[model samples]
Target: MAGRGEMPMRPARPGPPMQYRGPPPMARARVEPIDREKTCPLLLRVFTKVGGHHQNEEFAVRGKEPKDEVQIYTWKDATLRELTDLVKEVALAARKRNARLSFAFVYPDKHGRFVVKEVGSTFSYGHGRGDDAKSLAELGFQIGDYLSVAIY
Candidate 1:
């Protein structure tokens, strides 16, 4: 029998663990890819250009001219992030306008129906952080008729 600390090396030694030559994995993937060209889901839900037509001033007084709504549908799978990004994008696009314009962060109701917050600026209507109706509603333009959400 082997005594304490004496003649205990009966088994042969094994080689050291192999070195991992491969590169370390990316740092937890990117936090979020910055897709400059990518538009979010909500952009599809845009339903702007509701009920208007290019007509002469003389024709408007007669009320005989047919009007059309440049309507759009609600983006079906608009995530909050996508919606917010789209709203901001639209607002930026409005830069060409002489006056500041409005956009809405339109969403659905509790009963699963779509609803528009107001026809105002995104600044005063949908602040995009949960509840910012005032900033959102401040939007002065309607994206679409209440019903004609341009289906993406």
Candidate 2:
């Protein structure tokens, strides 16, 4: 019974309006560290179709190449059965890449010479231990350890 220029519809602005207050739902997703040599675009055409050389071969030049490098030592000299045969060649190349391996342990700095080691900034695939995989040190293989593997 209250018509005549009715302006009576303003009783609905109490509990949850004005865009629900503010700030309470942003727990994860702010990562920004991508600079793989300016974002690996085919990484120089897959290193020129794999003919770039230097695959181990004892650091190439005459080692027979193709392996890139693989000579880490430690873990208590790996119970010396010839360095425990490099854990059956790093577990048979991690079971042929079905995935399963992530190692990080190569120490040598402060001018003792020997270096190389850096991985894990978030690159997905599988197998990752401690920090990831990167290896060197042993400037000439005295056994400070190693693990320069890239077997995918």
lDDT of 1 by residue, 1-152 (tens): 78888886576668887888899765532223334346342223243332221222312233342242222333432233333344444444333323223334344446654444433332212335432333211222233223222111
lDDT of 2: 0.32
Instruction: Give the least accurate 10-residue stretch of model 1, judged by summed lDDT.
Output: 143-152
Global lDDT of model 1: 0.34
The TM-scores, one per candidate, come to 0.25, 0.22
lDDT of 2 at 149: 32
Q: Which lDDT tens digits does candidate 2 get at residues 1-152?
A: 45899876666767855666588886643334444455532200001001122232332232342343444423221212322234335445434434323223233457654343422221123334323332222112233234343323
Q: How many residue pairs clash (N, CA or C atoms closer than 3 angstroms) in each of the candidate models, in the order given?
A: 27, 7
Global lDDT of each model? 0.34, 0.32
